[model samples]
Target: MTLRVLGIDFGTTYSSMATLDPVSGRATVLRNAEGEEKTPSLVYFGADGTLVGTPAQNIMLEDEEEAAWVFMAPKRYLGDGDFVRALPDGRVVTAVDAVAAILTKLREDAEALHFGGPVGPVVLTCPASFGPSARDALREAAARAGLGDVRLVEEPVAAGHAGLRDQGQRLGNVVLVYDLGGGTFDAAVLRRVEDGYRVVVAPRGLDRCGGEDFDRSVYRWFDGAAREEHGRSFDASDGSFNSPVLRACRMAKEALSSKPKVTLRGVLAGQRHKQDLDQATLEGLIDERIAATVRLSKDLADAADRRGHAIEHVLLIGGSSRIPLVTRQIVEALTEPRGLPEPLRLGATDFAVAMGAVYALVALDDMAPSAGSPWRVRAPGTVFRDVDAPWCPEMVVLPRGRFQMGSPEDEPGRSNDEGPRHWVEIGYDLAIGTCAVSFAEWDAYAPRGSERYHPFDHGWGRDDRPVINVSYEDVQHYLDWVNDRLGLTGREDRYRLPSEAEWEYACRGGRETPFWWGGSITRRQANYSGDYTNAVKWLGEYFKRTVAVRNFVPNPFGLYQTHGNVLEWCEDTWHKDYIGVLTDGSALVKKSSPIRILRGGSWNDDSRNLRSASRNWFPSATRLSWIGFRVARTLIS
Candidate 1:
């Protein structure tokens, strides 16, 4: 059996877990020791020993002084050491350790429940508002837990998956996550890409301004009222003086959400003090905080829109969303500002983050065959695929082989460039695009409407059709962009126009013939002008121009349009014949000619010109309707 995946929402104030059977697509929230779905993110260290979750919380309620040594909401202290606590044995624990301890406990419990074995991959969720350092600390903490491989995902992005999983497909891809937690607030815009969500908009957030702040608001109101009744003010410098009120107010706040009013009692200098807290008054006190959180969401969404990332839906996540005011304000702020469609209200708001993390694991599993090579996707019925490259075209993997290049002198429809049938060896496997690179793929990196980025499409079918009117120089720019996107994985330099021999070997698809499927070309076999098929006697259809790629049969290597469609550019410079070409399948670069080799005749070419052996060349800067190139990725061994 595959190791189970558990999503850990190691939140600021509360932590939750969800076990995912990725293959089955089932996710269930796992309860903590107290049989509750959520556990307080508190850790206690005292003379009695270390304790966590409900037990740590239980000691806090025993006495204000006992809770002082207990760490609560350690997530806020991730970056700083101000909150570091010293154990009785003189060992110190930082925020990271406290978090690790919590996770270790959660892991032990989950494994006891057999989250299918002694170990499983864990996906940890964090607020999107967390920056690189803060997020990095989260990973470090999980590492300390001795858990399985850990993956990180933003809290809001996780919530978006949790809310939208059943929607099947989306009309618009961008989603905004509005997360207001117990100790932090985050608003982020995530774009749903092929396998997972991409953080298009950096999240906006406050280190504070959470449910705990609301508790403080109610506490302050009660303290002011009690002080006025006593005709004296409570000392603010004494931390102990406020601890009791803070604890009572937190409970009162939760109660006020359901009750019209709740009476909170606290002892001040040996006297019992009671204050009546009303829902209306509590709402008034925290209204500004709620509005500020809403403003942050709109501001982040607006910033994303300015950067060309539009918000299509808003996903609400966090324990604080149980508050009606928070949800109502978020709805109004996100929906009206840009008239985006109404946000999807998340079901089971508390578990959304954890559930979303499980979904993230599933996505990672689909995209990656192993832990190390995540960018590659291994699937049946086709060659290897590059799932990570944005705007990546479908590609087929062709293994190394020795193929005879060019055509025999006696072959029908042979050009002079096709003579001297010579052997060329391709040493490395290639990932060739299944079709010519489309306009949609090109526009993803560079849109046509911009004056700076054109070689615009000539009003031909844009979707799935090869992007034409692009010069050799334009393809170079696009390749540069693709390589940059490949990043420090050292896969950057592995993509280029196929060398002429490599192109020939791939187009032949392991066959030595005029075409991959025997010498005869037909309209049903490709998108080219097939009327002049003298080799076969049948009058074929004339498409007039390029049609949607792959409308015809694919070659033996699972590559489409290898015989016709658009003539593809090769890396080699112009060569009149195969006389001086390298025998090892490298492209021949000549500094003298401004032209490069073009192969696999276009849809506008005659049948004789559509032969696999036919070849042509044009100046490097030439842009023509019948010319578009496919990308070939060098397999990184």
Candidate 2:
């Protein structure tokens, strides 16, 4: 009798499941009842008290408070004091319960799709930063979903396993894994030895950062402008944010990514307020946040360096990695004086984790097979051991090779960021995270006594949605804590910011095109403003704010939300002219000035800012919602 294993990548913004068919030897992504491989991590309780997915996400738009259903993210508070309380009815639900529902849905899908027997043992991926309590919560959630045995795996490790398996590549030395998600960021350095992979350092992460903040930043900026123009306060306290008008404004913000402009129209206290939001205004509003993410990335590198370990290459992962600003910031930060070789190129962002999960499952099975298994597994001599020092995830090794880097020039609607049109050579290999970071990962490295340590945000929503309102300094502190715990010197050169060239090269996934999908940016292609396209009177009339990550399609490289989620940070000093610089793809930081480059466009940005080559700058000291970052490592042969 063959046993079936299910792997779950329970993401903050989206959730997905995969399984290895014992008979077919093929991995398959399970589609929900809606016929989609991924499901929104949302839950809504109806007046009849029923939970829903896309439908629930819709209802929350109109009756946000009373919708009794939350959309996007709600998984950050698994073992904390946080609980989702339904107002009026006062029905309280734990984060575990909410996540259990989604898990149960996945289990149902697995059972329905099963060709042999029921799904047996299960493996779930978590961020490397998850502490004991958070891991316990996941175990409990899995138990509640009726799984007999549950094994926890770090998301990056799973992604690494999958990536290596897919590419038939292996790592021979210590490598770093950098993971950025919709709500959190994490980093880890691991070494591959004769005994298998062992984490040489404790993973580090930030609690309150991700793509969601970008949306809110854009929304708040636009809300402030609307209030100023209409002479009416549109504060969340004043119910203006909750009003249909403000919601409409948010819708417009989401729409602008693909369209030239979007309009926002609504009544403010019986008065009409209508505004046309150009791409420039939207980019301007969230510029500060973009800078903050860049600063955070530098701080993370600096913190790692302080511990005496030099990161070999920087790994980039997460849906938000697609933004042009993200790539540019990374290039500026890590690239060298003239040019040597572009830092190692990882695959696309979105698929790294899922693919990693697949790889991990195969690897694990090969190492420890049940008795009487007939499969001819590779590396049968491999032994399995738990990552003892607080496992988060693993980074996959991306071998240097010649793969298609961009879409054909004849492809319609390609953006400049996609290309001046060229085929470039990536000569070196690098490691990348198998999946995006998670809330559990953030809590592991949270400052014990810092103000940012609180598990839940009373002013905002839930703890699991991703911690926000953190400064670049805070992110550095978290990285430092991880370094201290691991007894490793995090050298500046070893663990540093990724150059812009590295970021874009990874995001392109061997394809050059305006968007990751090889054409124009669409709502279905990514998480930006498509919902408002049909609702507003004009294309420009939608509102602004960040939505969830995983709300869009993955680029050819399997990365998600690269174009419009949150701007990411890169490790370069701000410089307008690149004429004399080295094109080898290393990062440069200015010692005198405390500013860094921010890459990627956010949910609130227009098409122009979303272009692959667009650049933005910010002070290193500042932190805002619309910005976050992924990480990379140098290849050590």
Candidate 3:
């Protein structure tokens, strides 16, 4: 069986659980015995045994007389060793015992419903303010619940992982995490690194500020209204109405988050009180607390700025962050001041911490080869030859790293399309052809009249010259033939054209200069025409026609003729600019048209077109004497 791990968000008021699906590689929330994603963190001491989660919470609300037996928010008192409760039978329950009961209930339900037998590992999320004693108390609780050696992650950092992996945000971003839970509010600034996010500013929070405080404010509003209308002080603290009224107030607070108005109705001191609360009124009641949270966020951003890190995004998580006021105030306060974009609140905010813990767990365990840990089958620049092939293109492996995909504005041969230079990360094992596909290699697949296979070498000898007159549409048939020869016909580890981003990254060969060799190029470096030069000190002879694939010295990546061979075809559609392109080194495939991208200036072109970041495009069927391609193979599925 595959090793399955569980992520538990041990919240103060409610808790949630999640695990990664081994096949899909997605973190999914697990439903408890009540068929709900969230389980209440309340545990009750009953006559026969202990009751936990939704059942215990229900009893506490339905039967107000049993409130003394039910423990609430035991997470707040985790480090206080003197904190304990005595039952009517003279038995005492500590904070660790209550937390352990909740964890045991969640584990039992998850194992029976999701995991086939027992979960392999567990990672739990906690507040960043947790000290040594609190952390030790949580570990003890997990141990008592039969969980062996659980890893604890900070809630804000976990949410940052979810934003990057789950939400598909850019990998190298600086984000601010705003987490407002039921009993606490936290703000943290994190910078995305190659392996994981690093904390730029330590998390800061308020212990007594959260959704529970908002509930109390709403309850006070209703109490004040009741006193003004009836001319009497109506008290429900000691009556049967206490639990039901508090529950109504909490529900109203939650409802107003998405609704314009909500009607709160419950019996208070044997008199029914009905009130309609609008979002504006609730915002007014909680404005002070919300402002304080925003102040904390700004302070964290200021600290990051002092360290020369610009925050790119603001991610909102936790239940209380769903309020309209929270998003609006945060956006207004953080956007214009720092020139950052509006806050991002994608998907449901309730399960971000739990889901992020699972993502972090997967990364820490090295379960699969991802962007953080790419599979290294062989050494970089090592050439590999396929087995049993009459003639195969030698593929040289390239080291995975990040590079700028476009030219700078001050470059000698810059264009408008290359103005906004952006970063692209290539984190997979990619083996690219050491040279352009030669006629010798192509003839092995399409010798003569092999189903619409026509050789067009432009009068050049078909012995070792680079193949020309091939269109993007025609390259598919050649790929099919090569895959069949290598026995990779329908597998993910197959041969195909390189993506536009990957081509540029390989062409640069770890240099930011115009050419891979230096700041300028001459006839000695490439095969391009010397008629047009850009920042070159010497003008040398011009090669009027295509030469052999390996006629010149290889680039630093061990790839020859990358600068002035036939224009290589890329597997990307034409885009006007880099407006919304992904930075993950994948092709941006738009099916609206067949205008594909091409790279590397040919021997018939000027030297300006041979710059590393220069771009060109043509229709899929446009074949010319200066057009060809190089193949790339994925080392792993």
Candidate 4:
């Protein structure tokens, strides 16, 4: 009966729901009332009552005239306020009302089958083509469905999240998503940053082209042949969707994927018609549509290339992407120049977007358990080491609190990007390394025997000294190694670099002064050069070489060398200022950038650079002799 989060993919033709599996750290799709992974996004209104899912689909096929009451593809008109219809009971239905009905069914099914009550946070997925109005409509629909404050994610971006979670690869790769659903086609390019992927190129897709169009073509071919045999033209019923002819045509299209030919039998315009459609003929009918998708994918590839990122993998998602012809076209069009591998075809194409939405939910809303649950809560200054890897850096638990991030304009040596100071709330307890990661810890992961990059160490000796000459990218490999050793590889709770906000908050240690000790810093307090002084009281001393991380006195938070020693890499992309940065203490990693934030100060920097609010940045791949990093652990309660 524990509260759980849900991710719902609201597709034009079908809908799916998923949640994070705490045990495996993977997304698990939830089955609907009929025990199916996917539910048809159809609603039928009749004199008896309202019907959804399979029953509604059955009713639609039973009577084509019911197309007036049966609603399908409501997703296509999400933001169209003018789109309104009336039901048999004399009730007016708008696009929002129809979408709400579908979402309500999904939520109820999940609660009944899994949670036994209302779930926790919900993440709803929509097409990338959705504008601000469409996004607002989706939120309004969820609200009407009784779902509280839900998060919104683009369908293709959610699919990208799922792809990365399933693969469990380290970050820094470019990927493309080709999504062909029942009523639309979307192609998006993404770059895998930190814990998620960012859209490299805005998504491009056709609003009115998808599997339904193919179904219409099959209906036309059969209707034309039937008219010729009967020697007469008959009355025309509803043009498409909910019509028995279109339903039969859709069934034939699916069967043709695996079968050499499929028989389509139906009464078109009151005339009984039956025909066998071969795969080749069906391919010819939808060739132009598939060609359109291929052209869109090529454009994305070229855009990524122009941005200096080569798409490493292409993921095919949504129902229509299952067609063999779609894959053949994508492979031929995208395999040149770099010999890109064949586009990946997921087995659960219908559920990829939903599952990916779950992964994104975990990334954005993940939190540790409360104190005294499965995870133990310890007081501040409590230092511990992982039992599995005793050589891991020692971590000290830090208390949670709110603090003003960034500096005031009046502060000495304040940078323009540091102003516009904002309040950041560190809501959960965290454990940060007592000092910067040492050379000994780095060597334990990539030893002399391994082929990993070995820093020069500036001939300053290795062991207990802080690790230097390391790039931001190199630090990620070490963290991955540590997580693997502790068996927390892809879980919500793992070792990672502290976010910039967390770094500044920890450095302050509940002090409002420029330095944690006071407004002035002395040579005896930290490991920075004293030749230049922010305040003249303590000046005229300098250490040209790096010192051991723990050689200095600990701050009020029991953290050592937080003010100096080595510049620590923080987990955030560099921005001009804190104008629109995250206020929740989480990393601001919306997009991938070559530059990343760096905190603290190095051995050769003046005292001004060692202040708690001082900030700096460097390219992620740039290795500097003064740059190193500390680790932080998410304490799951």
Please report the candidate that would top lDDT against the real structure.
3
The candidates, ranked best first by TM-score, are 4, 1, 3, 2
lDDT of 2 by residue, 1-637 (tens): 2567777888877777777755666556777777877777777744566464555666776564644445246667765745554534556667787778778877877788653456765778777556555766887888888875566666655654553344333332534555666666555554453544444344556554555555566567666777788776655452434535444655665575567688776565777767788766766765555555555555544533543445454556666544445545555764342232233335545656665565455554333446553322112112111123332323333334443433344554333333443344455544433222223455666634756553333243322223333444554565565434432236431323456666666565555555555545554444334433112223333325544444444443434456665566777767654444444555656678677776666655655455455556778766665665554555431
How does residue 67 of candidate 4 score in lDDT?
66
lDDT of 1: 0.74
**Against the true structure, what is every candidate's RMSD?**
11.3, 23.2, 22.7, 17.0
Off by over 4 Å in 2: 21-26, 62-65, 114-117, 167-175, 190-200, 233-313, 335-348, 365-637
Deviation in Å, model 1, residue 624 alpha carbon: 34
Clashes of 4: 1
Which 10 consecutive positions of candidate 1 have the poorest summed lDDT? 375-384
What's each prediction's clash count?
Answer: 0, 119, 0, 1
lDDT of 3 at 375: 28
TM-score of each: 0.57, 0.52, 0.56, 0.58
User: CA lDDT of 384 in candidate 1?
Assistant: 27
Best by TM-score: 4
Decoy 2 TM-score against native: 0.52
**Which runs of model 3 end up more than 4 angstroms from their true locations?**
170-172, 228-241, 365-637
